[model samples]
Target: MKIVYKTDTLPHVQQVSELFRSSGIKRPYDDLERLQRMLEHADVTITAWDGYQLVGLARAITDFSYCCYLSDLAVQKEYQQNGIGRNLIRHLRDLLGDEVSLLLISAPSAIDYYPKLDFERTEKAFIIPRQA
Candidate 1:
């Protein structure tokens, strides 16, 4: 499959929501307005497309200098395990450069996946859970 990566375009909300659902990512797929807002506010969005299909995405908010919060990384279930996710992260890193630190709160199922990608597991992070 010839996958093309793009940093300039934000995929439509419907495409993103569907990918989130199909990828088993726990996102507000039923809320299009929220999804749109999410995409609109993100500072960095990298998408992988196989022709016209969006196969993977990495969305983040960053200062382009010090820190980046990778809020979402999703790859369609059929496209998982193909290194798409890793490539997405790598692309994000290339954009952020060496001085920036990337941070993400992993979904329960993805806790183990991060370490294999050179991410350090740290107990130092804390969160106030969203009441949604």
Candidate 2:
């Protein structure tokens, strides 16, 4: 198993969407190409692969200086509980270092998961949706 950074791996986007759906996360089926495009400017994207098969993914949007928002993260259901998620978080953190403000909106089920990755709830944090 190896975790590597890749941005143009859109062929694996269908697999990624399936993994998200299985993980109970809502995602557009046609968004694979959209995701591939988004990754073009992403600060970093880490993918866990088992010899060319993508099994997990973690991506973030950042200014490369002040702030970063973890956009999405998912591991194959069969690959869960094997520490892939933790490894993914660590990899992203190392890529960003401590200079950027890292943030993510975790699902209610992941309340415990994010903290395990050293993320904490902030009292002053809030978001106002932007026009689409």
Candidate 3:
């Protein structure tokens, strides 16, 4: 049960895609090419791997100077509640380290989770299309 962290790895992309769907999150579905493109451009990514298997991932987009948006943060179903997500957030924060603003949108049920990671709720709104 070794949890290793890394960035820019392609193999984890599929696992993350599956996790997104299984977890009932809708973005990044059915487009591995686009997903790969997006991952390639991300400012930083923190992934937790159990041995060779990717069990969790946290991804961010940033200017590396002013702001960072942590868009997708997920721990595989089996790995949840084991502090993998917390580790990912802490590592990301340390990497950013007071040099940039990190922001993330959490699901209603998960709102309290980020505050423990030092994320404060801002008076900001996000818009998404229904696409139906």
Candidate 4:
């Protein structure tokens, strides 16, 4: 199966909600408005499509020059082992360039996955936690 990658377009909220749910990502998929705002505010977003179906997505909040908080990286469950997720990260890194650092908090299910993509595990990070 051939997957097309697009960075110039953003999918509709309904599409994203469906994608998030199908990808098994712990997002507020039932909240369309919040998801819409997330898309609106993210500095970078990359999506993978397979003949009109949304198969993967990556979203980040960044200053474009320094650190980038990679907020979301999801691939439809059926498509998970196909390298779509890694390509999404590669596309983001290509756009962000060498000077920018990409960092993200992995979902419990994905703790082992990120390092396979060259992401280093670090003990230097901390979070106050999201109450929602």
lDDT of each: 0.96, 0.74, 0.78, 0.96
- The clash number for model 1 is 0
Q: List TM-score per model, in order.
A: 0.99, 0.80, 0.82, 0.98
Q: Backbone clash tally for model 3?
A: 0
For model 2, the run of ten residues with the poorest summed lDDT: 3-12
Model 2 scores a C-alpha lDDT of 0.74
lDDT per residue (tens digit) for residues 1-132 in model 1: 988899998999999999999999999999999999999999999999999999999999999999999999999999999999999999999999999999999998999999978899999998999999
Ten residues in a row with the worst lDDT in model 3?
Answer: 20-29
Error of 4 at 17 (Å): 0.4
Every candidate's CA RMSD = 0.5, 2.8, 2.4, 0.6
* Candidate 4 similarity to native, TM-score: 0.98
Order of quality (TM-score) = 1, 4, 3, 2
Residues 1-132 of candidate 4 have per-residue lDDT tens digits of 999999998999999999999999999999999999999999999999999999999999999999999999999999989999999999999999999999999998899999999999999999999899
Which candidate, 2 or 3, would have the higher TM-score against the true structure? 3
lDDT of 3 by residue, 6-116 (tens): 765645568767766655554665787777876787778788888887787888998878888998888877778888888988888888878888887778878887787
On a 0 to 1 TM-score scale, where does candidate 2 land against the true structure? Answer: 0.80
Q: Which stretches of candidate 3 lie over 4 Å from their true place?
A: 8-12, 22-24, 126-132
